[model samples]
Target chain A: MRRGFPVWAVYALGFVPAVVAFGGGLAGTTGPDPIRALEQTLGLWALRFLLAALCVTPLRRFFGVNLLRYRRALGLLCFYYASLHLLAFIGLDHSFDWAEITREILKRPYAFIGMACLLLLIPLAATSSNAMIKRLGAKNWTRLHRLVYPAALLAAAHFIFAVKSWPLEPLLYAGAAVALLAARLAPKRRPSLEQPHEA
Target chain B: MLIRVGTDLPIASSEITPRSLWLRRRDFLGAGAALGLGLTGVARAASPYSTDEKPNSRADITGYNNFYEFGTDKSDPAAKAGRLKTKPWTLRIDGLVDKPADYALEDFLKPFSTEERIYRMRCVEGWSMVIPWLGFPLAEAIKRAQPQASARYVAFETLVRPEEMPGQRSFPRIIPWPYREGLRLDEAMHPLTILATGLYGEPLPNQNGAPLRLVVPWKYGFKGIKSIVRMTLVAEQPKTSWNMIAPDEYGFFANVNPEVDHPRWSQATERRIGEGGLFAKRRPTLMFNGYESVASLYSGMDLRANF
Candidate 1:
């Protein structure tokens, strides 16, 4: 109970958005262009998860909100949604046309950055388990997981270019990502004795 | 009047639309103020250029749109466009035209005879729809204005009421507001270029550009600027809203060319809305959006470069 909400509930809440996005999409409730709508909705959820996971640190630092136990769950959810976003693009948007998909990935900077972001996440997501962390040692695992910062940045870039215009929603998401990351640069006190972080 | 079948508005059921079909559509209008319109009850002629293809459902047509003045998302307009009051609207036509006046919306639409024109609309975002637009040719108004020889281009502008249009008030400006679009004089005078007042045999839904919108079938859908407030005939080519925003991605001409891809997305194929559900293959896009009769307009020019 001291840990607040259970980690499994974090996962359950995550699946709710996935179900709503893909389920609403497949059922044609999202509108006429359900494939594109679903693709974007999944991508939006991924960004939200990445931002939420990144928030765990700042909330602990400033607001004294300890959501550390669920950080792994949030990060893993980001990976799941990111993969779904790509699946929608490939399976629905491009229909598994490897040649066309490859050409688009090479040609558009957004596609290139989006693919690169998912590739970068693969290693972090793979190593998220406690057993893998134990094998890699705490110091190395922390360093490797730091890849999330760049992943967040790349995810924001992919969203901006994909939108094609600098609309407020994408820009607001981008601003939040940058601000959450920049919060790390703020002067800090010594880490709490209960939850020691990377030195 | 140099009126002949311009292109691709193929002679599909040129006779009057059946009264029973109009009665069937009456149930579909759903509280829209179309019944009050004088254009109602007058049997509209089927366009010689009208397409035989089934038009998209009114729900799909209105529910999904890109009236950036309302918002950026496809569904944003449908949700937010209710704030716009289509009543007491004014249209200002000036610049190199014989008659330059700020005419009321009704007076502006008074002269032309209305008909139903079905056009295949292709979006720059790689989606397409077949829309049955109820309006008259823009050429009819252009002829009435009697453009001077200096009028090489015709520019149009959308209304910019920030109170009604939430998008106009957005900080950092998603698009430079009072969205503007233009067409070459010949393109404007072409019989296919229509000033659409309504669609689906009812008043145009606010989301789908209520009151007034342009329909240049040969060009991309963005060129069909909505809720038009101004028309200017100028000597030099005008700056369009999208072209002004991103010069490389959106060019001035913006003709529907499968060969000329957008900087981010392929234009070679487009998913037709309401055709097939989620897993269906996208249909191949056509040059000039399959309106081949207008090809002569760009005979010597390069579409790829103009794109």
Candidate 2:
């Protein structure tokens, strides 16, 4: 077996819990509080999958593990989970009441932030394909992908604000993300072989 | 022996006619439904929990809840409440009461026959539920306590141990310990309101305030404190849990009036729990939860401020 797992395998594994969670929610099989269980599961998976996608770059740089092949797969999984999260909210809570939904979007600050995050992810997901990346050019694609950083922050904020009274869990995730980004920015010693080749 | 033929309590007369009993049953069911027992299984005329009864249909069980003891989620109480320590519970009735006493759970509950009353429970968050509650009037319980003339208001306190309830650890310290609720003497003695010990028949589920809880059918659910540990009859209005947190948002008289909307959201409409899909239509909320007969009591007072 290879030291590294395949990207497709990782993606398949990620979807398993999410699909089961959604199915359980739809089937009303969640033990007692089915609605709450479904909501928490969808939201947790979306954030967890998004964090996994964020880790790909740092993992590659820090450990010299060139798992670039898995980045696209992880990114796709993030989109899938986020979409499922949105659908769960729409299907279970709103019950398709457009008027009520519009009211909630306007009234509740968390709903607006969540929708904003979802909107930002749509473009990123659409352009995740190799063909789209080739069309956009590598430099332009990198700049566009940077949007994920803010999207993650916004998603975390949505959770924090929605649960106005409790913020510990969400705060922990936000703090860790900030630390990860800080690690990315910290100056790194250049490799002797790369410096000689450049000179 | 005091004989209750149908609904009439004949203290001295023992010779009861079948026609009198039938008439009394008719008066009891018809008047009781109107007076708001909202009883179940009986016909619309003979029973209170009828399909077409607007007031009975509107009592919301979903929104009006303080599940903070179980977890932060709105639905947490229904699930996590099953684990609560409900047995061997006692309610200490003291302070300005002529008969300052502690009643055991069974003895406290034994005197009255539990009746199911459906009421709309509106939450500050903007949702509502129609719950079928099993209990007698709050007035009956308080009368048994025999409050002194000094008792102008009744204060209720919930259990506060962090070990028993996990949510206590999560709440902001600013929120007062042992969630409390209060009611004016008249409101406390309102015939429509109930001191609920059981719900949906049998004993109350823990999350639904097992053992004992108040059911103020007219007011919001938070006014109905669950897992009550103490009942103190006081002269002043007690500081309620939500009101102390945010005064403007939650008020003392948390009546279910759709007209006086919450600052964060509208109270004009509510989603009937377990009724619609994600796209289910929201039904229009009623004034005073359709308790027009009782609406006049608050006519002169500022409902928005009191809310």
Candidate 3:
């Protein structure tokens, strides 16, 4: 039990806020205007946490920080919160109006951005399983997961435009995503393995 | 007595109060208060403006707000405002005024008679709401303040603190703190403009600018700053939040004229809150939010540039 402290604690800590949000949502505590602001906040946080998770892999591989097992859990958590955010829109915000939903997806620019992000995640989540990864092969799986880069960008746009004013927060997230992507694309000098006999 | 279409008011200038005319038309229904009110309603039902009401575009006056001083979330004011100690509140009046005086919230509030006026509140975001605000004309308050001639503009300030407001805890400033707003002397004295202390017949929720907040009927909602901590009669233009952040997008006027669109989106249409029907219908947004009664005050100025 004591040995499980760190892992369980991380999971527990993350669950606290999500559980509070869920309870608050269920209790109808947010007065009349809850769904739009709540969904945007949760989606933004999920995207932020996902970016943090994505950074873990790069940090471990490039900077040699092997203590990165938490990334997988955090990534799954982001997907969990993001799924809730999508559910809130369809269930609460739109009340599952099929015709209205269709029109919104067609007419609203931000709606398309949100839809694209959620759609991209479905495949990513399906491929998250170790069994599905083995079936796809490691090389193919990595390429598929690269969709997260665009997904994050789309999610940020979904939030920025969702607001009537103050795009600073969304702009900051966009900047961070661009910087991370740039770092990943930066050319690295691979050390030649076969070296002549050194003195 | 011309009741012309596209005019600020439907009735002639002789009949200033539509409510009074409406009451007379309802006399046939009999004189009891409830029945009289219902009769007035029947008259409203028969009016051409009934269809133009664009009822669906109304916001839940309770929710359509962003008073960040109390908290960051839009709903925070409504939720966390119960904690605000409004009773025994005192307002200190000073600076460029003939009389520098301090008054308690209740004593100062008692003399002003309240009227319920439904005004369209347009957020810079494109969505809008029609709120039934219980307020008195701001001109009444300014008249009492009796500012000196040097006082050319009215400036308002919101209480500030990083600890109480989570938005302030962040590194990058998302919005200007002590959220300031201003109005030119003539604009501040517009007949339709109000100084609101309550809504839905109750003291305003702290998020909605409890104690006192200005409601410029013709301007975008943010111009109605909340949690007002101070009011000063100043000589120059005050630094407003949106203007300081992006001057190109937010002008000093920030009027609700559909003609002057925000750079990012069209203001020609709006979604009225609380009126359900997802993607209900689009109605032509009124210039100056149907407050042309006050628009002439800005006749010589360029609205496009001032917007």
Candidate 4:
């Protein structure tokens, strides 16, 4: 029931997983392969945040819940996690062997899909600032942000492919992503009497 | 608990390995009570090659497994392999051998004495674990058969009971059922190759191959076929399950060589399970999983080509 959810709160919550992963790593509690576990955790959070960012529009349209202020924070957090996921693969797994990393990106479908999703997110992250948003004009900025939909789908694909077998957790994330995207396609209904009309 | 050792005490090199120390901590504590009596040294000196790396925790080892018969998910084997009937198992040794026979699991193991071997298990997926296995050398079993001179390869096969193995019953089976693996005759006869029947000083868990399994220390884990039902000495290189399914990805000689990368990923480094944190750096993979003794087996052959 809290209105105007603070953007700083979203950011603080966003970093909780990172802190837990770091603490667990230091304590040697992450289990036999901490690097792989950390990589998976980061990638999963990236997908969750991306899906959460996509949920904002549908939530406002259908449920009359306004979380527009925190949408940028969620999107940025998604990008942050995505970056860490890639870093874990390249730095920890590959040991900065650029040749091997490039080979993996080209040869592995999951890696290619993940890299593509991150690449698409880079422009969105760059244009997130108010100054760039104003410079690009409202219509172009809105159009550019639409890329989030495809990026989310790519991320879901990456998650599915990354696992040796298709597990339920990744499938559930993919299903949620599809449902959110489908909700955007639904026809907008007339404003309810209880809801305030946007000027 | 801490034990002060005198300078004159002759400690086995294996006792110093991180994995041996960590895994034998309980035993070590008990032995610490009688440290000056040299009882602990006698017990520790028995192992042939115990690496310095610590074996993964029992929880990690038992909880995470890759027995595809139960299912493909790492946890699935632990959850479902309990259904397997390991007691009434029989192993068949035949083909190009002086004696072709089927022996009950217990009867087959009666002739040989089991020894504890701590080895590094490197999965083709680029994850690795140090395990202490209880079994006798594969050479002993092969010697019993008296393989013919013409025999050039050894083929291994796992049980294919879809009724018990849910993964085999899965529609659109992932890998071919009745999983198969093979090794060159020389590789099979090597002292490092073992037919493990127990692990961690206990009867092997159902998920960890139950009654019997192969433990080829220097090869990728898949080469160490589990839940084995048949082993045949053949005149030609036998077709292996992984090699048949994805010939390009998995080759006949699936040695743990960092130089040859899997089609999907690099094998230069591997995540050592139960060690570093989630964000911890991966350890660089060692050739033949650090078993330099087996290097002579592949002399003059291109590992990358074989891979």
Candidate 5:
């Protein structure tokens, strides 16, 4: 168990929120509004996993922690949570009412932004496999995965707009997204050639 | 705590239904009719109306609240309102009333008989619940005050104490302190308008507006101001807290209309509390929250324009 953690563990961990939410809902433990609680929980976990996936590179570069092996798994898990979040909105909130769903998409800015983020994640989730990486080539694969940054920002904005008031929780998530993106975009430091060599 | 069981209340034969039967069904049916009806007779006879929907669980009703003075979070009121000192509370009735007077909490509630009112509470945020509130009609109290002919509107105000209510001290101020709401004089005098004092057969929990509060079922939940401290009969429309903060988003006549959507969200559907799974299906919202009895009050008025 110490040598290298199984990727299946990450997959298993990802399903925990869904199970807990459903279980809590059925058992009457999700307070007065179980559906809203469930929807919010799923969406929050998706955002958290997306942020975790974003942190993988920054952690390795800044803190020298190598979690590269689990990066893809984390990304896939983020996509999985996002899919559930979308399904919860469409099936539970809207009850497959296409007309109402369309009207909501048109009226609610947050809903539109959330939908856009999910759409961007689809291609990344589809191409997460080793075979797809080989087919696309390393450079093209890296380029395609870059969509995650925008997706993360949009998800953060979606969270902020969803609430009635500007509470600290959504603001904190938005701050983290901004800081992570700044770190990713910052110029890489290089050793100066003009500096004298140490004896 | 007073546990008013279904079998212990007198109910009208016409009011008995599948839902009411389910509540009073098993025990009352098996027991003799005289014994069963006799017990529930007083409560049922006094209560003029009630909803068919099952009341939300006591925990849900008290645990989830929206007393903004305590805080903006739904759970904040439940967490913070325990510190509120409700025993020494007083209510002031003034303005266009001939007999303006201040009454202590006990004295304020002494004159009227309390009865259970099961109502559908729909929040502007698109969530809904059926609550069983125990209180006397607002008209009973208003009648004692003797409003003059000039009194066209009634204004309600909540208690304001920053130390007791932390949200009042919030920097940048989410809402102006001493939350206020108003209703047309006719609306305030309506039979459905009540000053709630208890829930689930117990004195109202602090979070759920202890001592006294208003329950205007036909309007959005916010219109039912909490922990009321003052009532004034006025000649003009009074400024309400939400309308003052965002006039466009919250109108004075904050009636529940599916067609009139909030600027940020749709009002067509609502997420019913304690129902469905994580993605609970949103049921279509009814006009005036299904209180068609009060429809005539808004006759000839454009709801969209007024909204």
Candidate 6:
């Protein structure tokens, strides 16, 4: 219904970053360590999409910018990027060695947390479609999607732990994730008697 | 060519630039171009100690680095290291040495002739590069200093310039600045150890430690401290930067042993630079990084425990 901000445009724009990230590596522009560049590019976009999706709720609550229609598209984009990140890790990084991948996911704290976040995202992504939403019912779908809150935290923690240093870059992302989560957790204003709901 | 191991083949005559002609050409290129070739001017020379395996491309060698003095990112060094000034450099030799005095880089380097030693440099982060470093053996300098009997270790320090090094100025410092590294007295005197002044037969690039850097081929690349300013002979083991930050993961020795893994990742293999695409299988890491000659340095000690 919101023609000012199109959900389809978000989907179209979301693919651009991924294309650029992969194209840079394929074209040898992603520096000497292209594996790291590509994986980081996909992973960062995943986290950014999650944060962008989180912003949709706040935008409507505070500024009365009812862009809630784009939330589903943003959430799906996050899932897609997260999936690609995982694929890069499992195949490109580890050479499709399932045993090594499993051992890493179990023993490495950062990898373990990152895998856990992806697992949580899977269910939400599976149920994002209208048919699955209808089958699961609105309340159940809403409850399932709330898993993103913890996933965001896990993603932030994974980013920090992977660096293994107190660098400013990872810390900045963690701070942004925490701030967005706090905004979502803030107590909601009671429906005002005088304030008419936007049609 | 393919990765040649355990072979020290002589370079073809075509590849070896006549030293006199090369020097004249370098003089003509001016100081800027003479420092390092811009991804195309890679120089090559044959040495008995040099491995036959191809050295990494100039771009990868310069662009991909772990010089945290510039910044933590691998590419940050190439981007920000241009600010470092290498002209009129001075190196101070002190702490338990007989002749403790400052020597200009030119005067200090005059005592010994530079050698072209193409060596494999392995980073603790699981990447590796075969770099051709040009410098004299570290023993030349250590012997010149005439260290006292009490001196059992060598401590090296990098210059601390907040104006030039943004990492030093960053709030919530990622590492304690004026980065430090050390080696045992014997390790410092080892023939494999050198004070690298240049790479690819060119003056060392700012990103790759301009004036002078240490090169211990048998150890992890971090142990080869960059942009050095001071060398101190000490009685006790000296504190190192990475060890100070994460003692559990980085040990004092920091030797390139594949058996002892880091806390977060395996060290059994490394991704060779300029090898292939992302999916290319990593080459298995070797003991002492294929410089098997250094194993005796830790003959009696347990590497796992030390690691």
How much does each candidate deviate at the interface, measured as C-alpha RMSD after superposition?
A: 1.2, 4.9, 5.7, 3.6, 2.4, 1.2
Model 5 DockQ class = acceptable
Cα lDDT tens digits, model 2, A1-199, are 4566877798789889877875775674543334545667777777777777788777766665556777788777878877877776776665666787787677867788888888899899999998999999999999999888888888888777665344367777777667666767867657863354334
lDDT per residue (tens digit) for residues B1-307 in model 5: 3322112335422244544453554356346455655645422432547886777777788899988788877889999999998877889999999999998777767667777788999999899999988888899999999999999999999999999998888754777778999999999999999999877656788998887899999999999999889999999999999899889889999999999999878999998887764557788999999998999999999999887
Best by DockQ: 1
Could you give candidate 1's per-residue lDDT for residues B162-264 as a string of tens digits?
A: 9999989877687887899999999998999999976765667889887889999989999999999999999999999999999999999999999999998
* DockQ of each candidate, alpha-carbon based: 0.69, 0.23, 0.14, 0.32, 0.46, 0.62
lDDT of 3 by residue, B114-205 (tens): 66556677777656676656678777777788899999888877766566556565545667686889888898887777888766445566
The residue pairs that clash in candidate 1, if any, are B9-B48, B9-B49, B9-B50, B10-B49
Q: Could you give candidate 6's per-residue lDDT for residues A1-199 as a string of tens digits?
A: 4358677889999989899988887888888877778899999999999988988888887777776788999999999999999998887777888987888889888889999999999999989899999999999988888999999999999898888568988888889889988987778877782155455
What digit string (tens of lDDT, one per residue) describes model 4 on residues B1-307? 2211111224422345554454665476457656665565545454666565667677777877888788777788989998898767889999999998998776787788777788899999888888878788899999999999999999999999988899888754667778999999899889889988777766788898877899998999999899999999999899998888778888999999998888767788887877645444577899999999999999999998998
Q: Model 6 chain A, poorest ten-residue lDDT window?
A: A190-199
DockQ versus reference, model 6: 0.62
Candidate 2 chain B, run of 10 with poorest lDDT: B5-14
lDDT accuracy of residue B56 in candidate 1? 85
Query: What are the per-residue Cα lDDT tens digits for candidate 5 across A11-93?
Result: 89888988999799778787777767778989999999899888988886666677878888889888988898888788877
How does each model score on lDDT?
0.86, 0.70, 0.68, 0.83, 0.84, 0.85
- Cand. 3 TM to true fold: 0.64
DockQ comparison, 1 vs 3, better candidate: 1
Q: What share of the true interface contacts does each candidate keep?
A: 0.63, 0.07, 0.11, 0.50, 0.59, 0.50
- Per-residue error for A97 in candidate 6, Å, reads 2.0
TM-score of each: 0.89, 0.77, 0.64, 0.78, 0.85, 0.90
Instruction: State the displacement of the C-alpha of residue B242, model 5, in Å, after optimal TM-score superposition.
Output: 2.8
Q: How well is each residue in A12-115 modelled by candidate 3, as lDDT tens digits?
A: 78667666665665565543344554566578768877788778756754665544667666767778778888776666565676765676676577777888
Query: Which pairs clash in the backbone of model 3?
Result: A164-B125, B57-B272, B57-B273, B58-B272, B58-B273, B59-B129, B59-B273
